[model samples]
Target: MADDPSDQDGALSRRRLLASSAAAGGAVWLLRGLVRPGSAHAAPGAPPGLPAGLDVYQRAYENWAGEIRTDELWTCAPRTPQEVLDVVNWAYGAGWTVRAQGRRHGWAPLTVADGTPAATRVILLDTTAYLTAMTVDGQAADGSATVRVQTGASLESLLAFAGAGGYGVTAAPAPGDLSVGGALAVGAHGTAVPAVGETPSPGHGYGSLSNLVTELTAVVWDGGAGRYVLRTVGRAEPDCDALLTHLGRSLVTEAVLRVGADVNLRCRSYLDVPAAELFAAPGAPAGTRTLAGFVDGTGRAEAIWFAFTDKPWLKTWAVTPDRPLAARAVSGPYNYPFSDSLPEPVARLAGDLVSGAWASAPLFGQVQYLLAKVALTGDITDVLLSGTLVQDVLTGDVLTHLLLDGLRSDLWGASRNLLEYVRPTTLRETANGYAVLVRRADLQWVVSRFADFYRTLLAQYAARSEYPVNGQVEIRVTGLEDPSVCGVPGARPPLLSALRPRPDRPDVDTAVWIDILSLPATPALPRFYRDVEQFLLGLDGERATVRVEWSKGWAYTDTAAWSDQDVLTGAIPDSHRAGGGPGWDEAVAVLGRLDPHHVLSSPFLDALLS
Candidate 1:
């Protein structure tokens, strides 16, 4: 399994060249191919009678991990919010559907379904091309500030802008490439909950990023005008609740989000923690380094356990006004080069798995684990262990080179640098995601139960000589939505957000997010995910509830995801409808009112949202 020296050298050179070019080019990479031609009528696949003066072209559609793809369809970029409204009106009149296309960094079919024909009456509105505009407004007396930003702006750009003004969000999704509108559409979140001694900061929320939205402007139907119009709604408005996390059922043009003062953070990575000890039952030995213990100490942590591995890579981030001596100071995001660019040997193993080497799942898992261990800690003692496939892949030369590159075990920097690590260059894997709402005391219990069931289920699959998972299990915890943090009176939680608090279970203040990832089209993955979903659905019984992470896979059948009728029509909607709160039903009704013509929706959303 050892990689050829020449191939390794070439791969390293290519990665270095890419990194250097990216640094030099800056945001040019995101803005490439965004130019609008003078004549849209001449463009291929351009439908007749489309809105004039818009950039129109034929663009193929692909989601994150390449799970859903389609041939070239009619696409356009609107330079202004009024143009967006015009496009929606045109689509509504022409019997066509308009799906807002961002960076396409999502797993769900909310934007466009797979196998959509080229001639289908669906036009993609490319938001990132022309709608990216952001400006910081005045600061408030409560140490909070607001930023008015268009939906097409990337999260990295937004944070960088905020950071320049000494403000930042408490948490955000790891990938910096995600568009702000796309992130809000899915109610994206990061791992954080209030620690034992931590105090709430004004304008800072530990829930999904959507909770920070104080006001948003979206295209909604105007009954009196009988057309779609750009309407601004405040958080206090009941209609704003549905627009906060519309799940692609509505198109948001721009938003005003509340933010707080910036804080530096030190992120420490640990690769030696045994999964058994870290996820042990609640009443374990007093000194055991458990997941809950880390959360109690820092309030922000994430556990990434590669499939079939014994130890998980646990990362804990603590707020540190000043950098510690042992921590390396980083000035920017995506600090983990080892993860952003895979080593040649690891890439080869992944290729082998994709080429149908099913039995290599165990070896793949171990290689991934060892790769992280060496990359983060510079310790290759595990790789030196005799008679293992991992040793063969992570040869002494690879370990030496990785160690020479330097360790990334501890890093301290601005919150944005430490919080955002994922890059578009990382391995593309499909995932199944969920959020389990439970009391803080039951966090350990939920982790233990999931770990036990996952281990058992994986073993059974292996025993039957079927390997489904090739990636890792990611676990993160966050606080439920608390609208007061937005500093808007009478504001309510996002009705469709998975982190929405259950009114009846006031004590269930935390949400434990669990995601299982694997290569796309892996045999038997659907069945494996089905089992996991069923287990989680009933994990805590009356004490907790499970909700689907909107952007990832869910509602599984033995053959595919989003196919289970019961989970889609019953379990999912019921989770929000429970406690008789104004959630699922209300959100659905409002979304219907906003887009009564359904110009912004696709067939998948029509079925799921209905």
Candidate 2:
């Protein structure tokens, strides 16, 4: 929000833009909907639904990627829980499949139940359109209180809303455009309690936003019931636990979050920390643990590590900086001046043409942004990356030795399209704590099949035992948010673990959460997924579990599970799963209840039930 003309640190200017044939703040109202043609699985009775006028081309767009120009489901938004059930019921009744979509944020067709033989006769329920309402936690008239937001609401809007009401989210990943529900659905997080004041180092005692979800309203299609039913559960739920972690079978409609008081961070964006020394660096331009004067007030600092480069640089920013330090001349880094309420992508891109043209070098997290910014501006995020074939990735940690080193083999290139979706799952420490924003490239069966960027990077680095190309990558830095899933990870009483079937086995009750995501749009997308997966499996020899991020990684990564049953739960596996119990048993019974006619089923959903 500064108007400094001398803002050489990459501050965007009007004249600089016109000189570069760029437009700043240009708004584009491109059609945003999953225009895929299909129907949700409804019961035997099909209400005379809307006419068959719905078609992909009819709407001019389809959200195969996620909401961000980042992913292909961008066109599909969130719908209310009721809307979710309606779509499910209608699809069931019409003898079509129903794929629950959240922000179309994921790349797998798991959410797509339309136009393809797998789910062509299915209904796609957009989830981003869902809205959220806030109030003081515990009805506090004076003191701070928790805020409940809808699953489909955008995180940017939620933050702004909370800020306006004298509050701020407790934590956030990066990227202002992501939604709360989408983040949690994929286990979004940030580097926790990073070194800030003097010494820049990493620490322990971290967690995921999944641990914050106090409650959630998930739409589990009860196939046997033949009627849509709503079930509300506590943080420690039974049947709802698995759904809380992964968006596989049960579709989430609402996420009741535990919010904190309004607070701002004093961010001092600094950089040049190469990725190679990211973990071992004693200190750089801005080490996360203690940038010292970098952050003033009680606010904390966070770091960004890029993947493509040779050294990991730090694009360090503070939650709040000291007044005296803030008064001094700030770093003239090229930064994105995001608006309080970021305009629609098109308008923002037009404006960026002018504002973004100031610099195109992405070395310090600048170039790829312009490209993505332009891609989004052109409304062809999916169109641009639509020329690949699909393949699988392994995300589960402690993965079988058989799959280890598979990437080093020759099976990779043989796949026409080899992609791996990457996500920053867990952040026990703020410096390393991270979350991933889902992208649109994952929607196409062809694109996600490629190797992940981070994976390749990790594989190359594994030999060296050091990665130095991470700090300040443009693709994911600007976007950050706390887990919006609203489901608390490792919460007391473990609601997420409560609703499992565990009568015969105690292990099913205590499970871990892994996220599902689509591949990035680039060739290195698969590598990103692999590196993160290996990181989760402690492949780095660090002996630490890599935190699972929602949009960060998916089934193919080694950070999460890929077993047929594990895939069903939709989270990383090897730990305990939802156990068997009356509550869980009852919940399973309802899947039958919701689809008595057995008309509602998909490889994605059936995988879960089987």
Candidate 3:
């Protein structure tokens, strides 16, 4: 414990709080049960003393979107696995739910939520302090080396660690700032669908980061021992699916991931594809620069179409051993300084929009497109002329084909550096995200439907003089992680991964993720999101299976997020149960058994698992 007077005062206040709560409610047994075992009160289930080498503090937590805020009474920085175990045991004994806090970069309420009961005692385990140990544990049977790391390690650190040894992941979240534990907890994934000319790589899984884990160490309850202990679970275990994507119901200490040899990558950027042709209706024609066509040309692709802009900045990545013609090489992440750091004009427009100029969103969006075009390509004159030509002379399809010639290229260090391009210091906004799993053949169908829906909704909002969306609509595709990638026989896909193939549609192997981001302050943002959510949710079990992105936003009601009863309690559970095996229920049951007392649960998790 620190020698600071505030620490003493906080401790005194906590003690007094418990005493007063019990006394005010006339609950004598509550006070008796909460009293410290060896203290003057000598209660039975009181929290044990802080273990040595652990620093406890009072801290307030806020989710990435600033939608949820929580102030935990007891928080600690655990330096080692033993420290994590000690904190878990103490919290369990004291009947306090234990939540591991990393970067808190996720939008979901998996850790702590706005609705968590104020009276519920909670303890946050801060993992980044000292739990970021990384070690190469020799090679695995799958040809890739086994790298064991504490879950608290940031993705950037882990990627750098692997890159130092000439190893890398197949795909990862764009933001390098995310912690490995946090990323895996929500099944974080990136856009990397195998191209037509691509070949599967050994020791690499295109699925969520959770899919890369060969083994993990978690602080689970040991009923026989009557205390929390670290248990190493392997990928082959039946309960491993649930653990891989715990959805914030469990605490993982460390994980051993399988990584393959690193490869140089070429990331090409283009901003000429017109929205109508790029997101054309399914099976419109044979030759078109559609999103699916781009994915077919290159295994990796991302489309960032500004709200009301016809042209979207399309980025595609390809594996390359050497530099290509007319390309530059980038050494680290955040390669797009123009996109990550909003330009002066864009910032001003965004500021105005956020400052109650909701009507200016359309104009704000156009200015954003202009800035991105000028900054990325260094030639705004041609782009401006081209946009005018697109609207005036060429039709949608003809204009799109003409614009496809604007592809630019650059080489990046490795998969890790190239894949992580987004920076936290960049734009901040609320987003609704989802995954639409369909067969590769059905890619056109799903994407077209989404694009059409989005376009139609934007038009409707415009007709009503409402510009709710202020950010781009992002689109990406990735191959579902086949169990074979784990090199384990009879291995199952992560039960909670959105990329998991539905039992009814075993042929599905591709997941098209879509997201719409906007400032929370935008007028009618919630209503717009709700409309979009309903449309996506309706796609479930029809053309494609719709699943919420665990780390992003979903379960949207007309007024707020995570508020839709049917979607939360029905649609989401049904999506997890798509395969018909012991699905969400079984996973929840297993997690519940592992923590029988629910010592690792929160109000949000309880509802999600309910």
Task: Give the alpha carbon lDDT tens digit for every residue of 1-610 in model 2.
Answer: 3443523634323233222222222212233232243434222222246223222211212232322221122122333455556556665566665544444433333344333332145544455444554443443443344567776666665666655555544345454445566666545544333322432211111134545567777655443665655667666555444445553455566666554544333333333333333333223346343222222322233333333333322233333323333222222211232211122332333233324321211222332222223221322242234332100111122122212322111111100011111221210010111222211111111111112344355447545543323223322211122222233453332222212223343322111222322212222334444554444444222111122333432444332223223323543322123232333234345455544444445664465444
Regions more than 4 Å wrong, model 1: 1-45, 386-388
**lDDT value, candidate 2, whole model:** 0.36
TM-score between candidate 2 and the true structure: 0.53
Question: Any residue pairs clashing in model 3, and if so which?
Answer: none
True lDDT of residue 224, candidate 1 = 97
Shift in Å, residue 240, candidate 3 = 1.7
Which stretches in model 3 have alpha-carbon errors above 4 Å? 1-48, 115-120, 140-143, 382-409
lDDT agreement of model 1 with the native: 0.88
TM-score of each: 0.93, 0.53, 0.87
Two-way lDDT contest, 2 vs 3, winner = 3
lDDT of each: 0.88, 0.36, 0.75
Arrange candidates, best lDDT first.
Answer: 1, 3, 2
Q: Candidate 1 has what TM-score?
A: 0.93
